[model samples]
Target chain A: MSALLEVRDLTVRLRVGGSDREVITGTTLEIAEGEAMGLVGESGSGKSMTAKAIARLLPAGAGVEGSVHFAGTDVLALSGADLRRHRAKVAVVFQDPRAHINPVRRIEDFMTESLRTLEDVPRAQARTRAADALEEVGIDDPARRLRQFPHELSGGMLQRVMIATALLSRPLLLLADECTTALDVTTQAEVMAILDDLRRDRGLSMLFITHDLELAGAVCDRTSVMYAGQVVETSAADRLHADPLHPYSAALVQARPDVTSTAERLVAIPGRPVSAFEAPSGCRFAPRCPHALDSCRSTEQVLTGLDAGRVRCERAATLRGRLLDPTESPTESEETADA
Target chain B: MLRFLLRRGAMLVATLLVASFAVYGALDLAPGSPIAALTGGRTPSPEVLAELNARYHLDDPFLVRYWNWLTAAVTGDLGQSIPLRENVSTLIGQRIGVTASLVALTSLIIVVGGVGLGLLGALRKGPVDTGVVLVSTVSAAMPSFAAAVVLQFLFGVRLGWLPVLGTGTGFADSLKHLVLPALALAATSVALVTRVTRTAVREELDKEHVQTAVSRGLPWSSVVRRHVLRNAAIPITTVVGLTVASLIALSAVVETAFGLNGLGAYLVQAALNKDFAVVQGISLVLVVAFVVTNLLVDLAYALLDPRVALGSRAS
Candidate 1:
């Protein structure tokens, strides 16, 4: 009820080899008003697909089912003018800044194109507003820069330009799909700060998708961890760091490189990330989870309350404090018993 | 930019010079003399034959003769046409207007009309796209000569709606006659432009910028005009340039079929009568046209793709 964007049991099936294979299976998420939700997952884990489906930007042949309700309006049912209005309201800043902006067009042309075309904003006013938007995103010499093409700018600068252009429509929800992934470490932090500042200043809702756990924890109000195309666990950003509910979340936390760790080797996940097809009939992460039991492999997962947000696990209540020290190796006796 | 253009200009000069040498050498090695063509191949006394050879520098050494022609060509003297009994430049020059007009019309039909259809086909995917593909494939498969014959049969003989030969008298009348020939010349290239342009537009449409534009609430038409077409222009320009160049040579078949006294027809006649000066001069012009066409295509390509243009300049 508190959410601005509520994706209810959304499922996306891609046509692969003449059959519809569900890439995102009933994945649900919500972003509250003026709040940022971090969607963290490895590549092919359906993080992008979920965001694209919500934005109605899925390619032809992608079958989308389930309801996506934004501001109490059915997102899936909107079309024509309503759909365009929805798209303008829900702006997306993609992963690669260069990939998403026409290289042939000047920054001014790109920034003012939508505003002038869609809203009938006067060209001069649009240009002035574009300059201001650029200035807001820490871009200096906005006037001079606007005349330049995307290739003329650095990766970070191009990303800032993208953000500036994205804000021209004055969207309510900014879907930043790894907007800083292609940037260097320093630029990534700057872009994230710029995004955070803009979100707070404009009172906007954001769905910040990225694989960087630390970044998500630091920037987002709440974090949702996806596995095999489903949100395995979602909790307050701070709580996700201190105590992750699901095993996959815990494993992801353990795999993060830490400066203070005293272990001989870094903790690694048991296997490669799985696609929806390779996912099991039961708990999707059961094969990779170190704490998996015989029953865990055979039973379907359901969301169970853990903390501020829900987790997809059967024994969530019982496994409370036991999953804390995820990096600690199993005892010799435990390995021998399994053998 | 100046440096790039200068380099291309230099390349043009070098190519023309090389072409002149090839044209000169090939004609020398070719059988039959300019004497036979000028004298109607009748039995001539040795003294008369010697006089004609000396007059045309046919008896001069290869290097001296080529050097002489090269110098004269640079000064706008393209040698003498033995068959037409006039300056090679004047003979080709008079008909240059006709051929140039034809080639320009064909290029227009291919680029504007063909690419417009291509864009429409790409924008509308189901039946419209299928129809465009089917039409383009059929057009591409139809040879220019066969196409000329077919167009003549349909429009000229049966319909009597158009002229079957000649460049016509006035502008409008000329255009009337130009239709079938232009269509015949344009068919393959129209098909080529349509297919390549459709592919280019489709590829550009798949790019994330198009998606970005759409997501920003811009209509697909606006997105296509602003983003997709601009990005697709480079590849389409390349195909059009190549097609035009190839069309220049292929026009000979169309010209002979229609009995037009254009460069293509002149070339065929010169080759048949062994009018080496006219043949050599026309060949040089065609080579220069092709090179210049490609050069312009490259320039246009650089404009569309700033990476290559700006990157080289930046460094």
Candidate 2:
């Protein structure tokens, strides 16, 4: 399928003092029609910012430069009523649903208001569609739930309601930015399952921004790793774990405790995560990578496609065989596995 | 909701009872008795004085006298004014409209003008904000009597737009006469309410729900109307409610300055003459008005935000 949303060379800068500070570098990514792509990173990696930028929802005065093409139209170029119509087709579910839902308003008003007023759907018709959307997200007795306020619902339930509210507008793209991060393990699993089923059923494209690599590996069709405002690697979710070309992606996959690994201690990546302001001149990860060469520090890194995915490391081609999979514990039986 | 209202009603009764005791105590502790005021400063005969004391229950303890007064007051008999020789309640009843009208008009301006300016400052946030803050600070710092004098000089004398004296005869006339005093009374409140509303709206603007509403494709107008206004109402109502007592105090000074025959003037005259019955009666009414105004403000939470109003029932 053709790309449903294409974000090319997107950069976001916020004016902090007299000067502009880079929040997101020139990051490029895409989501195909009916595809679920995961943008994974540690805190302050600009994953959520990327999701917001895609929807053109940045706060006023934020300097945004890039091309965001959705269904053959430039999202950044749309203005007036066109922008309003464009926003309706793109829905976002943020972390902490309770925080995003107005406490003074009932769930029904919060859910149906956009549909009735913005979408120009009739009240009764909006209510009907809202109920159906709620049911699609696995919420039972939606009519009763609608009358309750945000404080009345639990965190997990509120998250489901948020998802349901997003789907009510029949958005072409759904942006879930750390949506399940605030939920518990069981509730997180439940929410993820619901999202998977709903996306497949509706053929809706989704960008799931998360920090949990394992979670992304489980639910996403493809995963893109972000670090200090740059996408370092993009590959099939399962393939990323078994063969990560970027050293940062390799360290991340190895950090997760595997149920199958017999090793007791996990390998820790040295040094702290850098902010955009603290970024180095070349190969963003060179300072921390164990395989860094002098060239890695002198030359800028560019994403080069190899096999089924892309990598940004300067030595990705030469180091491919050696970087087989760090996720495998040192003591695990390599002979027992099929190559 | 019914239970919440009932509980608030009971609290109001308790508040009024305590206020009545304090008012009655101050009068009882004062130098002369109501009978002394009745006698025009002359000593009465022993038999006449004893008969007066017995009939009026002036010889009873303070609490007993308070109970008698309260019981009679509740029955629409607030006792006869010593100086006026008219029913205390009746005197106040006649003048309540004047003061109520003044207060109502003043509060309307304070709420609408203050909140409107506040929203403008918070939404626009440049010269409009600076102007609002400067005005609020200046007016808030200015005393009500001083404000009254300046308003009288500028609007009443120079402009000759409104009457400079007595609470006018009819509704329109009275309202016209009340304009100066109301504006004077509203100045400080306008200052207070505007600051409160501006802060509230500014805070609400930063709330996540506001951003969420915009992302939902709601227009700027819809997002502000649906989210910002209602959320800011809570803090604004609180500021307005708490200002009632100060507003009452301002009315007394403003009424005297404007030479309006309102209940505020009645209160000031009664206090100075030590007309114990009128003083105590008006004091009790003022206390009750303050309490009831607050109760109504509290009840408004039920409509503005269901979370608070439904708090007791939901739990």
What tier of docking accuracy does candidate 2 attain? medium
By DockQ, the best candidate is: 2
Fraction of native contacts under 8 Å reproduced by each candidate: 0.72, 0.70
Cα lDDT for residue A256, model 2?
A: 79
lDDT of 2 by residue, B204-276 (tens): 9999999898887788888888899889998898888778656775688888988888888889998878788
lDDT of 1 by residue, A53-169 (tens): 888998879888888999878999988889888989999999998889898889999899878988999989999999999999999999999999888999999999998888778
Please report how far candidate 2 places residue A68 from its true position, in Å: 1.5
List model 1 lDDT by residue over B18-57, tens digit each. Answer: 8889988998998877787778869899999888877777
The Cα error of candidate 2 at residue A82, in Å, is 2.2
lDDT of 1: 0.87
